[model samples]
Target: MSEFNTTAFQPSLFILTGLRRLAGSRLWLGLLLSLMYIITMVGNCTVIHLVRKERSLQEPQYLFLSMLAWADIVLSVSTLLSVLKVYILGLYEIAFDSCLTQMFFIHTSSSVGSGILLAMAFNHFVAISKPLQYTTILTSSRVTRMGLAALLRAVALMTPLPILLKRLPFCKGRTLSYSYCLHPNVMKLACGQVRINILYGLVLVLFSFGVDSLLIAISYVLIFQAVLGIASREGQMKALNTCLSHIFTVFIYYGPLLAITVMHRISIRSSPVAHAVLGNVYLFMPPMLNPIVYSLKTKQIRTALRKSCKIQRS
Candidate 1:
């Protein structure tokens, strides 16, 4: 039998490019990403803490918000060290398995975030459409089930990524496009045929991100329809106001993802710096912005925060 092709070598280590073009501006980028990471951590943690400590925030909507916060925390943390290593410490060597693990968590947590947002959209619909039965429909137990299902779905859907990636040979250069591992970014560096990888990624994105976004949009459409049926404009506006935070959140979550997905397709002609910047934005913006948006827009969160502060001060 012919010996295995010598050219198809698997690398045990992958090098993260880590915004190489910005080597001249590493300090500013490092400081900026570091501060953003810090804020992401602080903001998400504060949301989780407030949700746990405050009785008024024990409702389904707030509970789902807390789940989103938890996912954001995990999503941000998954990439934190790797990014710091690349930007701050000038380290690019990540073990293959370590890179795979990071990729799994990054994608899984993002999926989890999407799932939680879908649940939140449903919560908004239920609250507006059937106010009298809002509590009854989204009881504590049901909310728990919803959250659990979201997480389980994320894990199940993302579990194949690392396994599939490990089976592929990587004779291609091992330099990754980003400081962290992404399924597409890593797969792009694999040698030989990668049609399966591309197809699988597209399928995953369709079933996960694409479906969730569509469902969330439909939920809002139904929500708007319900609001329009109300007799007075003020009442319609009030009902719609309740969904403002969720709408903002959906925007932040889906907008960057859509941009990144499109960016990957056009990456050949796109500026490398644009690719790096947008990918980081896609990862970091939602985590950093979600809590701030809620705190500013939602009355209940503010009220709960004030009460929590008073109790703690006492």
Candidate 2:
């Protein structure tokens, strides 16, 4: 761990610190992650398919749900090869270029997911507060632009990570903390000063999750305020129920993330297994569960699914 050098750079391979040679838990972890990957793909793909198939689902809310599904699919896919190789095939060494690519996609897709949640929150607000204007406000063209904007934001923020790390020499051992590459974990492996990388990583987290969470909270507050004014308990419950799925999705996506961050800061001495389990939970839970929550809770999605199933059977 010395200062920065002026020599020409050569890439080095890094190993993923997957499940530490559990005699049996290793097998179980592989099977569990495999199942999760399958479920995530199927669940999210179904949502996207249904949103495309049903005419009634062309509205803004379901449109955003489909985009979220797409982002989840990308996120899950970004980790699948590396994670499965580490856990199942016992392969650990990843080429530096590939690792950089993996890190870029992982961060960008996660950022895209956060942005999508913010979009969903705003969609819920518009639907709840200004029902009549929802269609006019969130036109299909506007929704398309929003999706593109989210992707662009992710790309802009994460583009610097691999480049910055490339410049620094990683005199520290080439071992990552998890089965996947994250900017925070990877940057810490660099030898020389990494204040710039650390600061930029912090900036990405704050802008992506911090700001989005705050906006979501504000949206919910306004939505609840409008719901409470509906004058009947049943009507109030109905209005509030519309937000339950989005709220739950947000919780599933961000709750474990926040918990992990808190634990990292406060319990610097926590067990490795605890961190591993929580990281897997944060990685796998939202993409696998989001579609299920929406399909079960949202009448339109459920009804469309039922009709689609009956048509296929007939």
Q: Write the per-residue lDDT of candidate 1 for residues 1-314, one digit (tens) a residue.
A: 13435335668899987676875767777888999999999888889999998888888988999999999999998999999888888888999989999999999999999999999999999999899988889999999999999999999999999988887778668888788999988988876567878888999899999999999989989999989888998999999998889998899889988898888866578887887888888998999999999999989889988887888899
Query: What C-alpha lDDT do the candidate models reach, one value each?
Result: 0.89, 0.86
Across residues 8-100, which tens digit of lDDT does each residue of candidate 2 receive? 333468988866645567677899999999999999999999999899999888999999999999989999999999888888888888899
Runs with alpha carbons beyond 4 Å of true place in candidate 1? 1-8
Q: Which candidate is the best by lDDT?
A: 1
Q: Which pairs, if any, clash in model 1?
A: none
True-structure RMSD, every candidate: 1.9, 1.8
Q: What is the clash count for each candidate, in the order shown?
A: 0, 0
What is the alpha-carbon lDDT of model 2 when measured against the actual structure? 0.86
- Against the hidden true structure, what lDDT does model 1 obtain? 0.89
